[model samples]
Target: MDMAETAAAVVDRQADERVRLVVTGMTCGSCSARVERALNRVDGVTATVNFATGIATVDAPRAVGPERLCGVVEDAGYEAAVQSGTAALDTGPEDRAAAALFRRLVVALVLFFPLADLSVMFATVPATRIPGWQAILLALALPIVVWSAAPLHRRALTGLRTGAMSMETLVSIGITAATAWSIVTLFARPAPVRGHGVWAAIMSADSIYLEVAGGVTVFVLAGRYFEAKAKRRAGGALRALAALGVRDVTVLTGDGREIAIPADELTVGRRFVVRPGARIATDGVVAQGFSSIDTAAMTGEATPVEAGPGAPVCGGTVSLTGRLVVTATAVGADTRLAGMIRLVEQAQEGKAGLQRLADRIAGVFVPAVLALAVLTAGGWLLAGGGTDRAFGAALAVLVIACPCALGLATPTALMVASGRGAQLGIFVKGQQALETSRTIDTVVFDKTGTVTLGEMTVSAVHTDLDRDEIVRLAGGLESASEHAVAAAVTAHARARHRELPPVTDFAALPGLGARGRVEDREVLIGSPALLDARRIAAPPGLRAALESEQRLGHTAVYLCLDDRAVAVLAVSDTVHPTAADAITRLHRLGLRTLLLTGDNTAAARAVAAEVGIDDVVAEVLPAGKVEVIRELQARGRRVAMVGDGINDGPALATADLGLAIGRGADVAIGAADIILVRDDLAAVPDAIGLAHATLRTIRGNMVWAFGYNVAALPIAVAGLLNPLLAGAAMAFSSFFVVWNSLRLREFRP
Candidate 1:
């Protein structure tokens, strides 16, 4: 992905580049779905609108511009603004929205209380009712409907213009119907007889429903206020990330002078000096000095890692105990921290299978409710009930039928879970990962860079020549290469001999080794296979050394001189500190585990045994790794493939759910469904556990939302439900669902 921090709207050139828009006026899931449908109408566009967060994440071809997408959303009866390219999600709009709703709600409540108190007084004591009380109630209700309820009414009208029926539409019509009926009854019907008692007044026109109008408006406004508040809190984790960048950084000039500059101005390749207790300006490698870096904030490692020259460090990490000079490698949105924030937001804005179903049902729900309401009114009239009774029944049906809860059932939970996960360095890429995680029976791990630390170090060396002579020749040729093994060999050589002889004609053989000329003689360094391919000779002792190193689960490389193997180097990778504990946790959760790698059988098995894995697939290339995953799946295993994401792309994509352990800034853009930014392997099990928690919350919300409509609609149709009670249920459900989702903010797993 391109560095997108320069502008508010970025049209990226990559395929399926994401464009985020802050959508306004979305009242329910149907409204969000409508925006998705409109945007999806553009070719090569896929979009998901999260009703709770009000963020619409759209992946579209570069040819289809963001303007067109925003225009499409505006055409679908909502407002749209492109979200800025920065990782920090602004809560300003949400706060403003909540304040506005609260102000309106206070006004509605002021009017609603007086109107309700008047209705209760009249109900309990009809003789105490004043002659002009209805007129006073009418005056109070007018503002509650026209001002307090204006937002819903306006959105309802917008959807109506587009021939759409949303939750807003249903709520708006119910409020209007109740208020309109009361207006007609108050003016058209004769006043009650002077001697009439409470029983007689019950059947008369004295029972106006102005309080229902005021109460519904107040309740719906409360719901909106709560929704706005939740949205403001939904991205707290990313917002913190956006704020973590230092305000200023001290840079080392070419002349060795130190000067301070804005953090964003420290571009790639710029050398900056970081003192103890200062946060690194951006992602970079230490060019000088040493320190203990507190990476716990970014990588979730409880202990500070040792950092010396050439050690990579993230921007948000703090330097402890020493000073260091770092050369920036990434800045702005291109940094790993920024990418992680974006990954979590995309998940927050995505729709799961169940949410999509709810959207479909919400789309059908409003119109079905309209028909049912009409049938209810007609049925009441046919049963010899008066027009007052029929209108009341119809009004109750309109108020009781709610789709807001259904629309919110999934995205609210996801938004909360994504934010909480982000704080723990877990980034969920999409909803499919959450759904798939609930069923995963096995986890396939890559040995290199996953079970083991992936960095190679020479453990021992066997050679006929003097140690210094062999080291100088091998390190000189390896210096020209960039492979991990070459780095290990060069570092080992440097420690033994401070300098190496200059080499000529250096050439690297991919996946094999390197060859060059040192001191007018051919020098080669690589695996034993490179020698066999070159028709070189290895004596029995050298061959036996190779076998012994491989048996010990160490990488063995041959150092050759003039087509003859002169020495062998045994290099090994350190096992990750948390691999064993992570595997044990997965097993405790009733999951099977396997290690899949391209390393030789002995090496793979050694790492597997150390990590407590039950099975190992060894000597498998990237494509062969996919075959192993497929074989496991063919055996009815739901597998989640875990890797560093650089070499395991194919296997990760083919698995049921891909959890990519983040290696650096450049990894994990699109390769995995779940990105583990933390270096600890424990996040693997934590990701799955978090997925299960989110799934359970979503399921509970779905049942309540759908079940309420199923059980309440019948009572409304039979005229057994009161409009005030129905309005309370409908209006509070949306707020209740959001409040339920907020429980995930405290989730540990």
Candidate 2:
């Protein structure tokens, strides 16, 4: 099968069962790698651990359980727990982790200033060098390097035992080397010496590095804390929606009595009542009453939609006026809101291609950094640099090259972008979707339901037979077919006939029409071309009727009885008001759009012109649609196919990026790379714009992070940079990466 066939077969795609575990105590990319290796050592388990999200997605045998996988990680010297896929996640653990980091930062900052002041006092002036002044500096920094920096120390020890290197290892070594030097200087070194310059004061054997220890701790904690806060705040919109939980709703019992009960107790086919200003209890089709529902909270639609009989309403939309009797279609986790939340969460958890490269680099970079630090210290001593100079430069190198910023570059940006995208009513399936969206230059739209509203109505009907009889016979034959034109005829007949004639020998032709025996007469309901194929000549008047509809941009449906054309029905579907605006926006992004459909050329061109589309390809079958997308790709166009979720599956899968425009209160779960929850064409541009911005942010962040290490390492190696400055730069580099990524939260299309 081709790529499109593979993608379109998403529902039938096969894979081993997967389990996700929430792991703890992983301090950096290396820690995660170690845990991953440990889990993979088990006989039937393949695992990937993501350091940014602390999630280990594992594929294992059915005999293996989640708890056992957690045990594997725990045995590798970390904490782990199973996170259920179907349940709501508890943010309590994340909150607690952030709070702990904040407390450590506060303690380190409180002590850091005093330690710096006392160290300067002991070194810069002879008069202020009182007895025990150096000891006092060490005492002030004691809590920071011990308690405030405890997590780093603990993780470093864990890494040592596992034969792995992490940022925590480099940081712990930097702090240890600095503190050990200070203790030795406090007792074994000479008394305080006043010097002429700043370098003369601290570059000698008598220098106290207590301040560097405290500063690094404060900076790393501050970066981690900021990242935690950004993640929580970025996801605020989704959390609030998820928290819109089950509430008491009035149910209309079988005997026509209303009783209040939890919405969870309501099942499919049960009728529920929604009063004015109240939220709909669940996903349902309106059985009675009329109302305008505020769907902004669920779908990000600014305008309200009028709901009456047969209108599908989402679970969380507010009923603005009139009481509604709705029969439930979905409940519990099957609701559209729940599916959206899950999609957003899944997107956040996915690791981008660049992020995986960063992880691989981090896995090896730490050990290489350790070796480089050793080489620098030894090289300095070999070149006649004194012990004081060699030790200081070595300590600086260790502190300056932590690799934390490299690890933070991509996943944090993806996390913020996913949450922000959700707020705009776009749900990306994964990082791969975002990556694909970034490259789209051509957008292909399915005309029906994509560019124009799919709902069609009878515009004009022509027949010599009794109008009622033609409507009845045509509607009966068309009802057995699920084509869009057939639906229009069926619905038009439904309003007048109330009951359709029973159809016998019913057979539906895929892209043509349907035929059956109705009330002892053979009936054929389809396009005029279908009649010609069966050796039935179209009467002159009926042929003129088809010509008139073609000129008027209407779909002409022909009804044939006993191999003679009898009547013609004209069906028209309205173009969405937002479609022109959506096309304008896509054009602004420098993208070309083409409208592809199975309708006649005139009808397709009319809708395309109304929407400002640049090209139109009409009279295409479902299989032909795939070939069109392939032809576009063969011309080197990076394509994004937009369609209604149900009928355009193959074409959607064929494009480089597939965007499914959602229906009112309905969510499509497969084929498309991105599913837009709003019933608005404008979401297409919004999604692409957001994807562009997110990728730009990620690229900028990586350049900054990699650039920082490249520039800072040389200065530290030369012993020209101060240890305190090295500590400060290393500490804030991660914070800078996260801050750059958070800018995506403010993105607007």
Best by lDDT: 1
The CA lDDT of each predicted structure is 0.84, 0.82
Candidate 1 TM-score over all chains jointly: 0.83
lDDT of 2 by residue, 613-647 (tens): 99999999988999999999999999999888455
Looking at model 1, the pairs that clash are none
Per-residue accuracy of model 1 over 503-553 as CA lDDT, tens digit each: 899999998999999989899998878988999889899999998988989
Residue pairs with colliding backbones in model 2 are: none
Q: How does model 1 fare in lDDT?
A: 0.84
Candidate 2 lDDT for residue 331: 93
